[model samples]
Target: MTMIGAQLRLLAWFVIPATLLSGCAPAIRLDEAATDRPIQTSSAPPAAREDAPAPHRPPSPTPTPVPRAFALNLYQEGDFVPQYTFDWCVAASIQIMHNVIDDTGGGTWADRVQQGQLWEMARARSSNSFNGANPLGWAKVLTEVGMGPYAVVSIADYGEALRTAARAIADTGRPVGLVMWRGRHVWVMSGFTSLGDPDQFPKFSVTGIRVQDPLYPYGDQQWGPSPAPNALLTPEQLATQFVVREPRRWSSNLPTGYMLVLPVAKA
Candidate 1:
């Protein structure tokens, strides 16, 4: 019985120590600051990669670009008239202009007698000492007879001169009278081809000019051949015949430059 009691006490001591060792183990230490922060649980999508194409929504459609080229021409059949005499260019120009403005083919004025009469009238109104009609008289005759409200305009730059004439024709829908051959001749600007439509594009430039030289097939000895009616002339081809006016050729307050018997919009 004593031996049995001794064995029991030893076993109890072992069991008691095992229980104490497990129950008294030290707790793991935690960082206080880390523990105080809230967990991030936002449902936002991940950031897109820099090189990724835009999401399923298609990128805004690029605007449809305008056509890079354009053209406008007002010439039609029977719009051309030739001068009856060498000195009747202005008169012939007037007839052609009337025909152009009278697009309906009503009252075409290509009569030779009328041409002679018109020439005499222009010569009488002009004061060019050489007995030839000048740009001022040409403009006056156009205005006086209801074909006008025309004006003589001079441009310093050849290119700008062409632009102005083209713009005038495009705006007024009437022909522009070019004072060709150093203020000695006349040609009608009927139409033009351009990089952009003059009415739409601000920076439009002229690519070709349509001309009506009353002296067609009978071009001057100095200037080159006259282009047929409604001929599309390149800017370079036109510069040869259409030159700056010799201011001394006529009396005027205008500075020496390129000239035009420009059509004015009626009020």
Candidate 2:
């Protein structure tokens, strides 16, 4: 009888615990419950545009800047003591030209050319035959220094080089003139004239403006107003002319038979 009573007590204990556990709700899963919460949605605020500057537009039909005689005098000093070698001078000039432009202000190539200080700096460096005669090579150097004009590759194309240079000159707003020397006589471009023949003396413009003065002995001439005179020369022409005419001229300080001066177009 006592054994039967003890067995009944043990069974009662097991049953009570089982029943209590089964009656309880699953421990509310906090992770799942949180996931059931709704997501909040609101439109993001628009970006601020208060401090933005206006976009820049390249000037079209820009004016060309003319170099003053005083500036020319800076280059005409001494018997052309060439500092720039054909290979090195052209490279150095392009770099220095762009640097000076950036130092003064950030604007189009025309803007830099118009600046007297930049012109003096460029002329001083480029005139030294130490640079190369190949303008395209010079363009490569210009790119490194951040003074590229975008269309500089045109120089590789004979017909396009002069036009490209002309356009760049015009954009620079500097003296839109060309300088050339037949022998020791240096002439400045004045204006273009339709010589009636587009071939030999092609129907184009001419550059010259002689100032009569004995003290100065002779004055420089300026040329311009033509839409396209550079069309005459092709890329092969430039390479051939510069390369063939005087293979050693560009490399040396001695005059390379002829000297051509090209200025930026008038702004």
lDDT values, one for every candidate: 0.87, 0.32
TM-score of structure candidate 2: 0.25
Residue-level lDDT for 11 in candidate 2? 100
For residues 61-98, could you state the per-residue lDDT of candidate 2 as single tens digits? 86654333111111111211111222223323333343
Q: Estimate each model's TM-score.
A: 0.75, 0.25
lDDT value, residue 139 of candidate 2: 35
- The best candidate by lDDT is 1
> Worst lDDT window (10 residues) for model 1?
25-34
Model 1: per-residue Cα lDDT over 45-110, one tens digit each: 999899999769767999855746666677788878899999999999988888888866477789
Which window of 10 residues has the lowest lDDT sum in candidate 2? Answer: 71-80
Quote the positional error of residue 95 for candidate 1 in Å: 0.3
